[model samples]
Target: MSTPASTSANQQQTHTPVGLIAFAWTLVGVPLAYGLYNTVKAASALFGG
Candidate 1:
């Protein structure tokens, strides 16, 4: 009825488990990226100014 990938995708949605991990990763990634960006900005400000 469904392809393997589709089946897995359906299962993933039905259980809604992996999405939590994905959401957490997104939350963590954004903050981590922002922190790194700000750190670089601070260093540049200190050195270049």
Candidate 2:
């Protein structure tokens, strides 16, 4: 007796927890931060400072 809308609603993707999302972003962020840090370091060397 379920309508299409009701069936689709039941099949919706589950929500990821806030903590897990943050952790996933951190997993991406760490390497990015390191790359930026190294880039800045290399750029600073060109200025001889």
Candidate 3:
């Protein structure tokens, strides 16, 4: 049988540093933003907007 304390200890949370988290988001966000920009550009050209 597992005690509550032992169960909680086993599930200890790991943390990522803020700088690394920001870098990871930037990696994902840059490509996403570029893709969205090109998509809107192409769509505007097609619609003559």
- Ranking, lDDT, top scorer first: 3, 2, 1
Which of the predicted structures, 1 or 2, would earn the higher lDDT when compared with the native?
2
Put down candidate 2 lDDT per residue, 1-49, tens digits, no spaces: 7567666657778788999999999999999999999999999998877
lDDT of 1 by residue, 2-32 (tens): 5576565466434568989899999999999
Better of 2 and 3 by TM-score: 3
> Could you give me the TM-score of model 2 versus the true structure?
0.64
User: What is the number of residue pairs that collide in model 1?
Assistant: 0
What's the candidate order when arranged by decreasing TM-score?
3, 2, 1
Clashing pairs in 1: none
Predicted structure 1, TM vs. truth: 0.54
- Model 1 RMSD vs true structure: 6.1
Total clashing pairs for each candidate: 0, 0, 0
In terms of lDDT, which candidate is stronger, 1 or 3? Answer: 3
Runs in model 1 lying further than 4 Å from the true structure:
1-16
For candidate 2, the 10 contiguous residues with the lowest summed lDDT are 1-10
| Candidate 2 backbone collisions, by pair | none
